[model samples]
Target: MNAITQINPGIRQQILDAFNFRHATKIFDPDRKISDEDFNVILEAARLSPTSFGHEPFRILMIQSPEKRELFREFSWGANGMMNGSSGQLGTASHFGIILAATDELMRAGSDYLQDHYARVKQLPDEVIEIFNGAYGKFQAEDHKITSGREITDWSGKQAYIVLANMMTAGALMGIDSCPIEGFDMARTTQVLAEDFGIDTAKWKPAVMFAFGHRAKDPEFLKTRRTMQDTVSWF
Candidate 1:
């Protein structure tokens, strides 16, 4: 039996219930703001999420101003090419988070960020750190040869999604609603951030976003999902 089955039945049930209670919230109650303490817990969940090579390549951008949220909403509809009209959810959300992936500078070998990440965060010894540096250097070299660093964003974006999942689940456990938003014009997003917010997109690429708040209405209770037999197999 796996470790999941070994978990106490009550705790296992609670875990499953948390997942069941979470959904891509369609509409958020604008008046209902998330408490700073509870939101900090959600951010902590993202910080503690696992990432490839322990790189911790994602940066979180918290959208606080109504004007900025409105700007994003307009960009989503006009230039971002969102078809489902879900991007407007950002306008109604009490909390918004954008995950940005790190650039080549931070991921490079022997960089101060990587050095500190290993020595301080992971507490690796010098020998292990040296090994990691060599391995990561080789891996990054191969990555650049394969895609000229274009794939860096994709690679880091995958890690950000892991963070996104953790944050959403953490929020759900705290009775907060969340939606993972992907349908937005990335070029326009980068442009707006640079022109308006003074964020240099050359250094950090926006990967994904999440909106959090109280649900405006009871989300449609549909538990439809692919059966385990269809999606998984036993050897």
Candidate 2:
């Protein structure tokens, strides 16, 4: 099945209920960790999130090893602002970091990447984000205007958040807790992974990361939620 297709409504309430139960965990139990299978379930959840087109839009880097996770913990400088750190005795790193990156390597000059771009665009039907991003790509090539690398990274990075939300929600349904981390030095991270992983820096840019593990205690506060009508109303 296409990853982006919305699930049927027979169990929509159950799914939304799962969402209601979800929250941004301030800490996870470092002594305990998620099973490999459950981790894959969350990865699949991310894979199933919607994208601008059929392009899938990003790659998943699951860093579970202690060394790697520690490296991220040390280098992750800017991701905490989004942590919503209302309160905490001590932060946990159970889920460690799951890196969601846009794979623009396929986005470069002639290769299967360009072909996949066209193919996905053809499948977009009436999607607005697709329409806009597709046109933007064309404009980039023809107008020959150079958008800063950070600009392109930021633009694509937004999509990763969508994937992050879905994964957290789905993980919550499985009785897992998550911390959506935006407090990290992404460029520096690219350097660390590049040296060891043999990954080319340009092909992938870090969009976001999440730490998942069992919640150690109650969150300090119930996160505020906006009603549907308040969040959306007819003009």
Candidate 3:
């Protein structure tokens, strides 16, 4: 079983208070950035997020170079809003942007882990690699829209969202600002990165990117939230 550390009651309240205080910051102060240690703490929160079947399926790409940030900004469709809106007054990301991805390798790797763990189970055949391979092939074939490898990546993408949320909440609690982004020229960005780094275009897929920095001003969280009374009902 996964063990969680006992947090102080006071600290837990602070964390909850932080969550309630966070909002989608439109702009960040360009002169301000999150400290390296603090950024790592935010990443650690993402790492601690639960995953399906214990397959922690995502790689985080922390991009920080000014040139790269500019290049990335060009493709981020959401940036136009940030550049011209309330966030503009505060400035834009001083810290690097984070890109999340899932690769074909991670899925195959997860399958291997599952097979290895199941090998010593009771009622399991001592030599059933062939049977297992066949079953795996069938399982792979069941995916209609994409290859089995791609399916694994799809599964990983969902897990990545859990990490995104954790990081956003964690960063906010640490007094960092974040913009969860899904609007980008993904294919173009992927092409640029893959060609530049010689990454296999077929294997890794871009999921989403996050913009992080210190908030230049307080975020106005004017959005409405649903209450427990509206959402929960005992059937």
Model 2 misplaced regions, further than 4 Å: 1-13, 77-91, 103-105, 108-112, 116-148, 227-229
State how far residue 128 of model 1 sits from its true place (Å).
2.3
Best by TM-score: 1
Number of clashing pairs, model 1?
Answer: 1
lDDT of 1 by residue, 106-220 (tens): 6667778899999998999999999999888778777544234557667788899999999999998888889888877888888887888887777788888788899887766
Highest lDDT scorer: 1
| Tens-place lDDT digits, model 3, residues 158-219 | 88888899999988888787877777787887887787656565656777777788766775
Q: Candidate 2: what lDDT?
A: 0.65
Per-candidate count of clashing residue pairs (backbone under 3 Å):
1, 7, 1
**TM-scores for all candidates?**
0.86, 0.71, 0.73
lDDT of each: 0.81, 0.65, 0.67
Cα lDDT tens digits, model 2, 1-235, are: 6678787786887787777667766656666778889988888988777865445557777675665555655556433323445222123556655554555455432336655565575443446545645665775456644255655455457678888888888788888888776666767778877886666667677777777888777777776788888898797
Displacement of the residue 108 alpha carbon in candidate 1, Å: 3.6
